[model samples]
Each structure stands twice: as structure tokens, then as C-alpha cells.
Target chain A: MAILNLKKIGVSGVNSALHKIVENSEKDFEIRNPQGQHSIACGINAPLNVEIKGHVGFYCGGMNKYAKILIHGHAGVGVGENMMSGYIHVKGDTSESAGATAHGGFLVIEGNASSRCGISMKGVDIVVGGSVGHMSGFMAQSGNLVICGDAKDALGDSIYEANIFVRGEVSELGADCIEKEVRPEHSAKISKLLKSSGINANPTDFRRYGSARQLYNFDVDNFESY
Target chain B: MSEDIPKTHPRKSATFDDYTLSEIRRAAATGIYDIRGGGAKRSVPGLDDLLFLGASLSRYPLEGYREYCGTDIVLGSRFATNPLKLKIPITIAGMSFGSLSAQAKEALGRGASIAGTSTTTGDGGMTKEEREQSEILIYQYLPSRYGMNPDDLRKADAIEIVVGQGAKPGGGGMLLGQKISDRVAEMRNLPKGIDQRSACRHPDWTGPDDLEIKIHELREISDWKKPIFIKIGGARPYYDTALSVKAGADVIVIDGMQGGTAATQEVFIENVGQPTLACIRPAVKALQELGMHRKVQLIVSGGIRNGADVAKAIALGADAVSIGTAALVALGDNNPELEDEYKKLGTTAGAFDDWHEGLDPAGISTQDPDLSKRLDPVTAGRKLSNYLKVMTMELQTIARACGKSHVLNLEPEDLVALTVEAAAIAQVPLCGTDWIPGKKNEILLS
Candidate 1:
């Protein structure tokens, strides 16, 4: 393990340091004095474990691939955006569009997430420990979004094949999204996801939601829903 | 008695034309707005409305074949460590694999590589064949992010952040169920045989301020190697161009309403964006105002057809021009030979635009395996390369006649408009008169 201080090398030098670490086949790294700098530790292709000491700004760990990034403090907008095949664990709350449009990854947020969380999420499995704000999972395509706490308005609006499991109450369901019965397989899946995300909650307590399939094909009768 | 009285001539109303009546009937029958492909069919002020004034007494013309007129250009030289170097100023525009067949995409790549130019990937992510065939491939990061991945981003020579397109400026993308094959479905992470509607706005970023950050993230991701281009429709070229430059773009691509699409509402295509002729000047003006005209290159598209259109676009201060519809035409799309098959589809050879239905006889815009097999990549690529060569030669010929050594040296002063609308829109003087419709008033006020 090696430690790189942002205060010494500056934010611009982070990429070169990451490249050097990857070239050397280094497995672990610790970044100190992050100070909410944007795009920190982003676009990492190699598989490595990285720990950020302080808060990070927008697009932290964006477009990540085959890496594990752990942020100790709060994250700004678009954290873990468009990530593919990686793991991002945010210990504190995150701003808007968490795990947005990610193709394949696992994002675990220990605290609450703001509006538009998992917006247009493709195949990323996201588990948020606390509540999520309005319009969360808007136009979500595929994946599993697990919310242990309450959800704000318009949850999973215009959703696609993605499954949403919420342990707490949902204020309202968006158009075309409906609650579903959680079967034994769904409980097992939820339980496995919770175990992976380090969340200790009863899988049966969560209720599943998904697309109603009514708005799959555009029809004259579904004009009102659109 | 009837002959002597003179038969009353049957009159037809100009307001309700034949085409208009047919369209009305179509709307009443289908209940859904007509969704099709290709560009605007309506006539507008285009490159044809402007003509170049060849050198006479005051200027010396370059010898046609003796003196060399350069057409080579470097795009995204502002920031990218490696910019695209092209033999000609004409490049192929973005057309997705799902919208076009895999064979078509391969043909585009092979043709572009032969012409020493670049081909782009569209809303659909980069295909394996497209990447392998194209020497210089520009990857489009669209709102859908369908097949977007970090590995593909690194593989691309350039990155184009799509804000809007000319065919449907503020609208999203639609691929009907007929086109979504197993391959397309797997790539987009959607079920097969479902109507996929791409988002109009990007999921993460919203405004220009956020766009700047987004650009920075991409730059960081790619290690600042690839040129970043911001593509916008011709709705508000001036503001969009300026804002793209401000957002740290290495290049800007402006597409006009005449630009082609795979599938979109006909009403949105014909009614929405500005003409290619009307879009160039404002975008150029914006770049000039920012003092980044040549520094941040501009690639204009929409209705560019031949070398004349390419030369005209360059004369209007564009660095390069892209072609979509014309390229398809060169690849045997809308061929007169396919007229009978087209008639079976209820359209003519040159009039077939229902690309969304996936019943294309020409095999250029379809996903059906049997239809897609009609196109041979090698033969079609050869034809496209030949067409690209002809267009380049034509541009060079025009540049020589205008007494310019390079295609980039062809200026607006060398062009005159044949129509008042063209003079006003292109800001060029009308032929035989020093009067430019709008500039004359500005000159008088000054």
C-alpha cells in the first residue's frame, strides 16, 4: 500500500500517480486531503483498491472499471457515474445522480442520496443505506436498487426492467411503476445484495417494485401515461 | 354546344396541395405522426443558392493540374495531444449500427479509411467491426449511453458529446420494435422487440456549467489524448457554439435540419431546426467573437452533397464538412434499380424514407439479417471511396478557380448569392450588386 497526498502533488497529478500505481501492479492506495476535488480517482481501468480520506466533488470515480474505490466522506453530484465493472462504496451521503447510467457495477452508499439517484441506471446494483430524494430511479433501465429507508416522490418513474426494493415507505410511485410480490428468490437476491453491501436488514421487510409492462409498447390508450 | 361553350378548366387549390392532402389522410388513418428517416424534403436556401466568383483580371488563378491546391486539415488541434489528420476536408457523419446494418457500418469505416478521413459511431455504442475497420474512429457519447464503456472510450480516436441533432433538436431517439434485433437488444441492455426511446436530456449533467465538469471528467478519463467535440443541432448556433467553446471543446460540430436521421417524427424533422445555410454564419460569428475561430475547429453538416457544397461550407468559415445522406446514397441507397422493390413498400426509389419499419430494400438502413446481406462491404466501400475522391477533386477545382492555394483559403468574399434570402442568411453580396440584404443596412448605419 502507498499513500498519495493531494496537498503535496495537487489534484492534477492524481492521474499520473494512479497510472504509475497501475503500471507497477500496486494493489492498494490511500489518497489524503481530497478536499472535495472534482473527478478525483476517475477512469481507473486496472483492478485496485483505493481509499479516499476526505470529501470528494462531482464525478468522483466516473467511468470506473475493475477497481474498488472507497470514499470516507460525503460525495458530490454524479458519483460513480457511468461506471463499468467496479465497486464504489461511499461512507457518507451523496448528491444528485448517484450511480447514473452505470453499465455494470456495485455502488454502496452508507448514508442518504439526493434527487435522481440511479437515474437511467443500466445494470448497476445500487444499495443505499438511508433515504433517497425525489425522482430517484427516473427512467432506470435494468439493475437492482435497494433502499433501506424511506423514498421521496415519483419513485422509479418511467422505469424499465430494473427492480426496486424498498424497506421503508414510498411517497408515490411514478407512471408505469407498480409494486410486486417479493417471492423467495427475490428475498434471497435481496438478502445476498444486502450482505454484499454490508447492510444488516431483514430481506422480507422490503417490498419489490418494477415496471407494469403497460407502457412497454406505445399505444393510443397509454397516451395519458406518457 | 359544349365545345363551343368551352369546358370550364378544373382548378386545384394551391393551399391544399396533393402531398398535403395525402399527409392529412395518412395522419387520420394511422393516428400516430409519421416517423421516418432521411432529411427535409422541402426546398430551402442551401449551398446551391450561392456561387463562387472565379478569378478574372484582378486575381490570378492557379493552374488546374499544375499548381497543387491542398485540402488536408487537422481537427481538434486546440487541446488534444493527437488530433485527427485527414487527406480531405470531407468526413463521414455518425450513423449507428442498429439504425444502419453492421455491413453498412463496416463499409463506412472502410470507405473513410480509404479516403484518409474518419467515421463516427452514433447513439449506439461502437461496434467491433466499426472499430477494427476505421483507422480513425470518433465515438459518440450520447444521452442514451446504450453501450457506453470506458474501454471503448479509450479505443476511440475522438469523443463527440452529443447535445442535440438536426433532425429532431429537442427530441429523443426512437427505434421501433422491428429494428431491435437480438444484437441490438443485447448491446442496449433491453429486451428484444421493444420500442426503445432514448432520453432527450443526459441523466447526469443538465446545463452548460455541468457540461464543463462533464467534459473535464472525460478528459481525465481519456488522459487528455482524444479530441473532445460538442455536437449541437442548428436551433441556436451562435449561443451553442460560444458555450461549447467556453465548456472547453476542442471542436464543435453543427448539424442543420437537412441532416438525416435513422428514425424520427416527420413533423419534428421538417419543422424544427435551421437550414444548413442559415446556421454556418451565426456559428462562425460566435467563434470569431470568442477569438477561437480556427483554434477550435467547426465541422458543419446537414445538406452537404458534392464538392461544391463542401467548398461552400469551407468558404463560410467551416474547417470541415460531414455527410450522412449523401454517403448513404453513394453506398447504393435509394438506387433506381431498387425502384420496383421500393414500390412494393409503397414508396419510390429516391422517396423511400420509412427506415424505422426495417423494410429497406437497399439494405443500408435495416437490421434484418436477410436484408442486411444484400450489401457487400468491399464493393460498397469502393464506391464510397470513389465518390469521396470526386468530391475532394471538385473542391480542389473550385479552390483553384477562386485563386486559393488551400481549401481553407476560400473566403466568403469569393462567394455571391443568387437569391436575396441566401444573401441575407449567408451574409454574402447578391450577384451583380454590392448589396447584401442584412449587411447593407449595417454598413449604412455605421
Candidate 2:
């Protein structure tokens, strides 16, 4: 395993070193002293294990693909943004817009997530251990967001086909987002996702939320809803 | 004798014409408003209202045959380690891949590369073909963050954060379902066959202070190599320019109301933002006041048609000009040859603005595979390059006539406005008069 110390090399130097490593498709990486710097490990394409020991700033692991990134400390806004076909594990809390606009990825936030979590998410599967702030999964088109803890107000506003599974106390749903029956098939999927995320929660404990389907097709009779 | 005279009925009011009546009727018939491409259709003060004062006696003109007038400009020299050095002072404005066919994007790239200038990867991120074709590609960071990826950000020669556009300052852009091809849908991370509306504001940052940080972050991401440009719609030019300068922009792009878009509400297009003619002077003033004039390059866009417009913009203290609508026209959009097809679509050639419909005959604006195949990128690219060459030569001719050694040396003193409104906005003297309305008192006091 190669160890990258941010304090010694600086942000650009470390990032460049990581980028070169990814380009070469090398071994696992251990990053130290991230020191809340932004864009840590961004644009990494090759399959590798990247472990950051300390806190990171915004856009950490952004545009990640075919890599596994594990952040030991808290992350700032837009963590794992626009990631495609990767796995990101944030050990601590994350700021707003976590996993935003990500198409394909598995993001696991071990701690709480701020507002707009999974906002505009396309196909990423996000599992948050702690509570999520308001407006989580706003305009989510695809994928699944499994929140282990309580959800704040206005959750899943203007959501599309994406599924939301919340375990704790309910908050108000946003426009077009409504509670749905958690069938056996959904519970099975939740169980698999929980296992993949390494969460111990029972799948049956959660409730599912999704688009009301009233907006799937526009009708002049439903004009006011628009 | 009376029968021999042709009977003439009361003429329709020029102010409330056929098109106006049609628009009203259409609006009433359909609850939703019209969304289309192109800029303001209304006539306003533009570069056409300005003319250069050629040198005769007081100023000596350069011999057109022997003398050389330079047009080279270096952008993003303020803070960027690697700046873009262009042979001409014109760059292609951002047009998204989703809004325009891939062939059109490639054509834009080819033309800009041939002309030794830069092209932009507009809203929907950068396509691989566009990246490979464009010599110097500027990546536009828009509000939606659609298709924005770190790889493309690193690949760009420069990055432009689009705060607003001239056609619709505060309005978001729309990509109708028809234009959202499979590739476009994948790039934008949206479902296929669904209407997509980009956000009006960025999700992360709110205002100027946040914008400053965002710019810093981008610089770090690109290793401080690429120049960062702040593009704003021409609303409050002075304030926006000043704020952009303060936000650490290496370059500023002010787009006027005449700037075209892929699709936006007609109301926003025709009734929003200031004209290009009224945008340049105030922006220049802001730069000058901040002691950053020429240090941070200014690229003005919107309704820039010919070489005269380019010269006029440069004379008014703009370092460069960007073209969008004109560029599309150069690439054979709304060509006269496609007039019959356009008529079938219920519009004429030169008036074709319904780009969101995905039924373009010229194939430049649509996502339909059959329609897009109509445009041969190679031929269209050559045409664009030829147009660019003509404009460059025209700019040189004007510069030579004005006795300027370099295009950048052309100043406001060499221009006179034909209209009072233009004279006031451009701060140039009206024809046959020594007065610019707002500046006369300042000149007298000075």
C-alpha cells in the first residue's frame, strides 16, 4: 500500500500523485492529513482502494468511477458528486448535497447527512446511518436512498421513480413524493442494500417512499398540480 | 376612372402586426407560453448603429497593402499559469451538446481550431468529439451541473462559470424531451424522453462571496493552470463586472440580451437584460475603476454579426467578443436552401428559432438522428472557417482605416453613434456633433 501525506506534498501534489497512480492502475492508497482540503481524490477512474484518514472538504471523490473510496473523517458538501460505478464510504457526517447527481455508485454515509442529501441523484444507492436533513433526494429520478435514522421535513420533494426507505420517525413529504407500501420484494432489496452497506438494521423496520405516479403523465385536469 | 384605381383597405397597425396577433391568439389557445431559441427579436440599439471615423487629415491611415494590424489577444493572464493565446479576438460562445447536435458541436470545434481561436463546451458538459476537435476548449460550469465531471474540468483550457445569460438573465434553460437523446440523457444523468429544466441558481453557492470560493476551488482542481471566467447576463453590468472581478475572475464574459439560447421562454428572451450595445461601456467602466482593466480580459457576446461589430466592441474597451447565433448561422443554420422545409414547419428560413422542437431541416439544432445526419460537419466546418476569415479581414480593414496598429488600440474616439440612445449608452459622440448625452457634462467639467 502506498501512503500519501497531504501535509508533505500539498493538495495539488497529492492529487497529482493519486491521479498518476490511478492512471497507472496501481495498488491501494492510504491518504493522510487531508486537512479539510477540497477535491480530494477527484476524477479517479481506475479500480483501486483509496483510504483517506482525515477530514475532507467539498467535492471529495467527485466523478469517481471503478474505485472504492473510504473517508475516515467528516466530509464537506457534494461528497461523491457525479460518481459513476464506484463505492464511497464516508465514516462521519457529510454536508449538503452528498451523492448529488451521481448516476451509478454505492455511497454509504456512516453518520448524519445535511440537507439536499442525494439531491438530483440519478442511479446511485445511498445508505445513511444517521438522520438526514430536509429536502433529501429532491428530484431524484432513479436509485434508492435508505436512511437508517429519522428524516427531516420535506423529504424527497419532486421525486421521480427513486425509492426511499426511512427507518425512524416520519417527516412531512414534499410535493409529489408519497409513502408507499413496503412489499416483500422491497424488503428483500433493502436487506441486500443494508448488507452491502454493512448496516445491522432490519429491512422490515423501514417504510418506503416514492413518486405518487400522478405526475408520470400530464393531464389538463391535473394542471394545478404542476 | 374610379374603377381603374386599386381599392386599398385599412392597413394593419405596424405596432400590432400579424405576428403579434398570432402570438396573442396562440397564448390564449394554449395555457402554456411559447419556448424557443434565438435572442431578442425586437429592434434595439446594436453595433449597426455605430460607425468608425476613418482617418483622413487629423489622423493618418495605414496603407492597407503594406501596413500590419495585429489582432492577437492573450486571455487569463491575470492568475492562470497557462493562458490562452489567440490569433484573433473572437471566441465561440457556449452551446450545449444537448441543445445542438453532436455534428454541430464538432463543426464549431473544427471552425474555432482552424481559425486559431477557442470554442466552448456549453451547459451539458463536454463531448469527446468536441474535446478532440477543439484546440482550446473552455468548459462552462453552469447552474445545473449537468454532465459536469472532474475529468472534463481538468481537460479544459479554461473554465467559465455561467451566472446568467443575456437572453434570459434569471431564467433557466430548457431541453425538451425531443432533444434528449440517449447519449444526452446519460451525460445529463436524466431519464430519456423527459423534459429537463436546469436550475436557475447553483446548488452550492448563493452569492459573490461563495462564488469567490467556488472559483478558488476550481483553480485548485485544475492546478491553477486554466483561466477562470465569470459569465453574466447584462443586467447591472457595472455591479456584476465589479463583483466578478472581486470574485477573482481572470476573465469576464458579459452577454447581452441579443445572445441566443437553445430554449427559453419568449417573454424572458425578448424582455430581459440589457442590449449588447449598452453592456460594454459600463463593464469597461467597472474594470477601469477597479484598476483591473486589460489585466482581466472581457469577452462580450450577443448579436455580434460582422467584423464591424467586432471592431466596435474592441474599440469600446472589450478585449474580445464571443459569437453564438452568428456561429450557428455560419454553420448553415436556417440556410435559404432549407426554406421549403422551414415553411413546412410553419416558419421561414432566417426566422427559424424553434430549436426545441427537434425538427430542424439544417440538422444543426435537432437530436433526431435522421435530421442530424443532414449536416456534414466537414463541409459546415469549412464554411464556418471561411466566415471567420472574412470577419477577421473586415476587422483588419476597419483597424487599418482607423490608423490603429493593433485591434486593441482602437478606442471610442474612433467611433460615432448614429442614434441618441446608442450615443448615450456607448458614450460616443453622435454623428456631426461633439456631444454624447450623459458624458457631455463630464467632458465640460473635465
Question: Quick one: best DockQ, which candidate?
Answer: 1
lDDT of 2 by residue, B1-446 (tens): 68989989989999899988999999788866788999999999999999999998889898885899998999999999999999999999999999999999999999999999999998788999899999999999988778887778888999999999999999887898888899998887777877777878776667897688677667766778999999999899999999999999999999999999999989899998999989999999999999999999999999998899999999999999999999999999989999999999999999999999899999999999999999998888889888888899899999999999999999999999889888998999987787899757433321
Model 1 lDDT, residue B317, Cα: 96
Query: Where is the poorest 10-residue window by lDDT in model 1 chain A?
Result: A15-24
Candidate 2 CAPRI level: acceptable
Model 1 Cα RMSD, 1 decimal: 2.0
Worst 10 residues of 1 chain B by lDDT: B437-446
* Candidate 2 backbone clash number: 0
C-alpha lDDT values of all predictions: 0.92, 0.90
| DockQ for every prediction shown | 0.79, 0.37
Cα error of candidate 1 at position A4, Å? 1.7
- lDDT tens digits, residue span A145-207, model 2: 999999998898878779999999768898789999999999998999999999789899999
What is the DockQ of the complex in model 1?
0.79
Error of 2 at B7 (Å): 12
lDDT of 1 by residue, A1-226 (tens): 8888988887667866775553657779899999998999999888889999999999999998888999999999999999998899999999999999998889999999999999999999999999999989988999999999999999999899999999999999998899999999889989999999998899989999999988777787676887
